[model samples]
Target: MVSVALAKPLDPCESPAPFSLLVPVYRGDSAHRVRRAIDSNTHEQTRPPAQVVIVRDGPVPQEITDELDRISAASAVPVVRVELEHNAGLTNALNTGLLWCSHDVVARADADDISYPDRFERQLPLIEAGADLVGASMHEIGDDETTPLALRQAPVGRSEIARVAKRRNPISHPSVVFRRSAVEAVGGYEHVPMAEDYWLWARMLHAGADVRNVSEPLVGYRVSAGSYERRGGPRVFLAEMALQWKLRRLGYVGFIQWATNVIVRGGYRFVPLKARETAYRFMVGHRNS
Candidate 1:
């Protein structure tokens, strides 16, 4: 007979570490998905967040606003809403949300994704263990959340993560829980089009931030044919080129690395849709195996 080991239950006497949840929502998000995302992280999780900060990047529809109100009233913990008059884009919205977070440790969640009940139960201890930034692998799922597509794995350990970041993003942004002080110390997130999170991770790595990634999947990331289609096109390729240039100027990557990354990762943005999806699936299978 073969035995499979399971994670032990958290001690009841030892209260979970306190951390704030930051979720930024925009006009395009669905009200139902937003509510589900917040509920999963707050009321449904084994370890609920101390506070939840929902940043309204711009004015959403009345239904979405009402949902936010209901979320605040029904939440077990404090929920703060930071409203911006105009759509300031993701980088601005994220920076704005960071200011309102009350705890030193902040966990990020997307408005459309669902977090596993033990997500924080698995991640918070790493933050308590002195890691400046911690992220986890995620299971890419369809809209229903039942259909699994691929496993996106993040590199583990400080040295390995740093080496990988020189060419590609090493952490899953939505599955991350990072120290507020550490992020602010590196000047917070900057404008990098679709690559803001990657840029921030690169900057943090260059600054010697202690980073780690849980090998197991903790978040259910939503993916679709539309998601794959959006990955390509001239605009996204330009964004990729801009990020590679930024990394080179920051001295985070050597000239050869920068050029190679530009050719490979940047060229990926121009691949045919079917080919791109197949390549992604192949990479996912190769890594998860």
Candidate 2:
């Protein structure tokens, strides 16, 4: 008879499962927010990452680099740094950082966002239970970073996630923790400008990866006035069209769904700045504060 050993159950009291926190910084990112991002994802987490991989997309101000150096030196975990000579944009930068992660599991953090203390503790166990990708709902905060603006919720369960991906991105990127192998197998974040995360989720869902989302909000997504403005504009509209076309070509969506997306999502980009912000808040369930 052949004997095989089953994996031991994870103990809640033990140290967190090993994972690498992946963050990409660019010239436009705020230095102070970056420091807070690094601190929250590491020191404040109930279950902290075993390692951190930060990718400098291009040249940043001396202040940003100095802050990064100071914070990284004080980090509890080992930090892996990668610098690109020129701006390669978010998609490329993320792909480059993905390669340097020391752990099989990687948790993504945006420089402007803040991950809650229980973020990792909540998501890690789902990964252990065979979820290739796990994301959570996020609370969108205003410029103050303390006032809640709205709640961006993600679909839970594999079936719902796959269904939602056919029409829209189901995962919250900043609140995600995914297996590196699963993501790399699907070609590590295809270039889609503003829609890179959506493109990735669609490809991974199509490939039958087990994706899930926690119902509780795990991250504070910073939403400034400029942030809402970026959602519209000509360049963003073109990017939305490109993403829709790519999804259709991949057989992830039919012509009807594609046209609907272009009409709905693409059209949203052409609206006035203030109107777009109002509509967005309504769509995401705006909070009074």
Model 2 quality (TM-score): 0.91
**Candidate 1: tens digits of C-alpha lDDT, residues 1-289:** 1111222334657666689999999999999999989988998999989999999999899999999999988888999999999999999999999999998889999999999999999998887767788899898887777765678877787788888888688888999998888888788899998999999888887877778899888999887669878989999999999999999998899999999999888888889999887775554432432
Question: Best candidate, TM-score-wise?
Answer: 1
Clashing pairs in 2: none
- Candidate 2 global lDDT: 0.85
> Which 10 consecutive positions of candidate 2 have the poorest summed lDDT?
1-10
**Cα RMSDs, all models:** 6.8, 4.4
Model 2 lDDT per residue over 146-206, tens place: 7776788777877777777876778888999998888887778888888889898888877
Clashing pairs in 1: none
Q: After superposition, how far is residue 211 of candidate 1 from its true place, in Å?
A: 0.6
Worst 10 residues of 1 by lDDT: 1-10
